[model samples]
Target chain A: MHLSFSSVIEILGIMAFTVSGAFSAMQKRLDVFGVLILGFVTAIGGGTLRDVLIGNTPVSWLRDVNTPLIILGTTIVTIAFKSSVKNLKVTLLVFDALGLGLFTIIGIQKGMAANFNPGICIALGTITGCFGGVLRDMLLNHIPVLFHKELYAVPCIAGGICYILLRAVVEPQIAEGASVVVISAFRILAVRYNWRLPRV
Target chain B: MHLSFSSVIEILGIMAFTVSGAFSAMQKRLDVFGVLILGFVTAIGGGTLRDVLIGNTPVSWLRDVNTPLIILGTTIVTIAFKSSVKNLKVTLLVFDALGLGLFTIIGIQKGMAANFNPGICIALGTITGCFGGVLRDMLLNHIPVLFHKELYAVPCIAGGICYILLRAVVEPQIAEGASVVVISAFRILAVRYNWRLPRV
Candidate 1:
């Protein structure tokens, strides 16, 4: 299959999400079906939510068969390499950060296409970047880390603002790439520095 | 305002959902904002999901300004009457059951209008009837009762099937009303009998 640059980024983002989801489910001792289901949910949950909110129906995942196949494949690969993978938590974090960046940009672009205001677009970006993990946590019967945890959504929000600002000074493609990098880097740095939001 | 029969049913269903949601949040000792948010979510979440799945854009709640107002009014009344309300558990269950039945019919009809298969229609009906509670439970950091608790979704499924069968032999209006009654009665009876699905 001839993969375009955009398609490659999409696949990588999906794979990252699937890996994080599979690892989380495995940590929770879910069964094989549970692991696969969680992986699929994490991979597509945010985008489906974004599409639904923006009134884009037959959600992107439903229309594209390859997305599920990729999730299945990623889950299997993660499982097969489980024993060989070291620093499992670190691996999950890295992939999650990458997916967060990619998905946030995708959501922002979709919001812009729908002619939403900048604030709404930023909200959509944060939701798209963060809600997959939120859904996964909710399914696991825990308060979403997004509600009370590290600097997660702040980076997405900041990146969204940066993207909007950058649009005036840079090419659209350059702004998109810069925003993704900014989000991913911010998240990784936050984790590295053990940064967290103050409790109320 | 002259209320049509369908509008009355819709209002009743939304009110039931809002009351149950408000009660659940209050039980958890949520603040005013949380209670109001949950009430609104419970009233609209199911229909929003149904519309999004069927590619219905600009979800029902977005188009209708009164729904939010109704939810807010219901939440206030529930909170104000909290002390006077006896048998809170029973009241919640009754309202939830009633909401389930009414929403199930609304969903099944929507799917039918979309020309979905009976199986898909039934799925949609069950989702509409059950997912509000699911979202509420998830937000409260608990496993959704729909997955492992009492006979919650079964009645919705059974009612959907009943509606489909009834449509073949009865008037459309009769089918809708009968299905709603069947679902509500089945759910109430199940609770009364403490009927539960056996663990695998």
Candidate 2:
């Protein structure tokens, strides 16, 4: 069966998220089963949360096993490609940044579609984008990257607003693509320059 | 100032949950800061998720600093009396069971106040009563004790049914105490007898 356009993008975003999570678990030297759990939780945790907050019962993931399957599949692929994962920190970071941009925009779009106000939409989007990674890090007994200052949550928040304003001023599709671009660029640039939150 | 009746019970439940979490963290040999995070999360995580699901603003703990203070107090007390924690495992287990009972009732009660269905109310109660510990264990890199062939989720489920049914048959205050007693006794008995879900 032919997949819908939106489902395709969502599948890609979810796949990217799962791969990043698996790689992080691998970095921590977790066992294979542990890697699977970490990837599954990290891929689903934020969206499960966003959906729960938005009153989506059974959660988006519990309703759709495909997402979890995709994560499991990606984890297998990562395991098969362990050598590459070992030498590709830059590439992994790029993929993580991409997932961050994509998921955050989609979350904001969902909130707006539900007709929540811009501020709430932005907050939902921020939660959707960063929470998975935060959870994964926390579960690994490490301080989450978001908490340790990475200029992370702010970009999601700002780009969510950009999506809202972009749609209001222009075409609808531009809002999605443009907002993703804004977040991705900001995140990559922040990493490139070692930007971080102020200590004070 | 005169506190609302429910608020007093809520604070007690939070304290119990916080103390239980801190004790568990100490059992796992986490640092002082780790104990603090565990306590805070256990105390507030369930309610935060519940409020967010209902689309409440700012989250419950964020709305009141007192919750943070309570969690902090629990953490400090647990650390200061770390030696006592080991010897007090049975006592901690009893309080943990109490926390589970109280949280189930409160979550079910909250859902009822929001006019949620019995099915959803039971689920909310289960989630509220259990997810915090699941989270604590997962973060400590252990499989959740609840999912481990155990009587953990059962008491919460039974208690929720009692809360819903008793409210239908009796006064609200009496139903509250009755549900708590039912849940607490159920958990204590299960622990004493080593009852659990059979392995899949």
Candidate 3:
């Protein structure tokens, strides 16, 4: 089965999130089963939420066998190279940004497909981009990254708006690609510059 | 509209969970909006999850406007009587147990309605009974009660098993009522006896 561009991005996002989750589990010294569970949840938690909210049942991961396989594979890789991977901060950051961007677009697209209102679509997009980390942090008994000073969900919301606006003037694929690029660049720049939302 | 017996139980569960969430938010010194958000999430989070898994769309809260109204009312009441309510530990415990039992049965019924496997049904029941508190604790940056030494999910799972078994021997309504009673009594007893799952 040939994969589409969106599917490719989705798989990449899954792998990135899985690796991130596995690393967190390792840092916490969770059991092997805990590591695997965290990886699986991080990779698909946001999408599962989006799908469920839109009334899509069983979720995409349950329908696509490859989703779990990829997450499992990523978890295995992370477990094997746990110590070495900890040193690859820049690479992991890049991958996380990529996943965030891709998931934001994917969530917005799904919401659009379901004919949700624009506000709902934007919210869905933000949830998709940021919620995996929320679930990961929650499971690890920490505050969610999004609820803090992070400029995380802001970029996702910006990208969602860009997608909505660009789709009218540009081709569908172009709009998607542009939105992903915008989100990724904004996220990476925000982190590099230490940009943060003001403390409430 | 005249309410059914089950609907009354569901509303009670919602109110109990909402008050629990509001109290947590208050303890954490969250703002009014934060308190309301937490209250709403705690009341409907588990049921929303179960509904989404079963392909039920828009979730129950969205369909029934009363759900949010009830949560809001509960939150207001909690905020107004916060100090006094703190002294009512036994009353709160009873309400929580009632909510847990009702939610467990509701989740199992939903899973059965969706034609899920028995294992899945039981899991759904457990999730429904316990996950609201999980979400509440997570949002409050504490470890989920279910993940720790608390004898929380055990009663839910036991109730689910009882529900399944009793359904085979009695009428569906009778089975449900019996399961709810068993769950509430077991939970209250466990708490009173300071029963706990051994720490890992």
Which has the higher DockQ value, candidate number 2 or candidate number 3? 3
List DockQ, one per candidate, in order. 0.19, 0.08, 0.19
Worst 10 residues of 3 chain A by lDDT: A28-37
Q: Pairs clashing in candidate 3?
A: none
Ranking of candidates on lDDT, top first: 3, 1, 2
Residue-level error in angstroms, candidate 2, position A153 = 1.0
- Candidate 2 C-alpha lDDT tens digits along B45-127: 77777777767644555335567777787678767776775587677667777777888888887898899999899999888
* Clashing pairs in model 1, backbone N/Cα/C closer than 3 A: none
In model 2, pairs of residues that clash are: none
TM-score of each: 0.60, 0.57, 0.62
lDDT of 1 by residue, A1-200 (tens): 89966567778778888877777777776655557656876788888788877777767664555787788888888777876553566766676777788789889988999899999999999889888888877776767788888688999999999999998899999998899889989999999998888899
The CA-based lDDT of model 3 is what? 0.83
How much does each candidate deviate from the true structure in C-alpha RMSD?
Answer: 6.7, 8.3, 6.7
Q: Where does the lowest 10-residue lDDT sum fall in candidate 1 chain A? A: A83-92
Model 2, chain A: how large is the TM-score?
0.90
Native-to-model Cα distance after best TM-score fit, residue A105 in candidate 2, in Å:
1.6
Please state the CAPRI-style docking class of candidate 2: incorrect
Chain A: TM-score in each model:
0.93, 0.90, 0.95
lDDT, candidate 2, equals: 0.77
Docking class of 1: incorrect
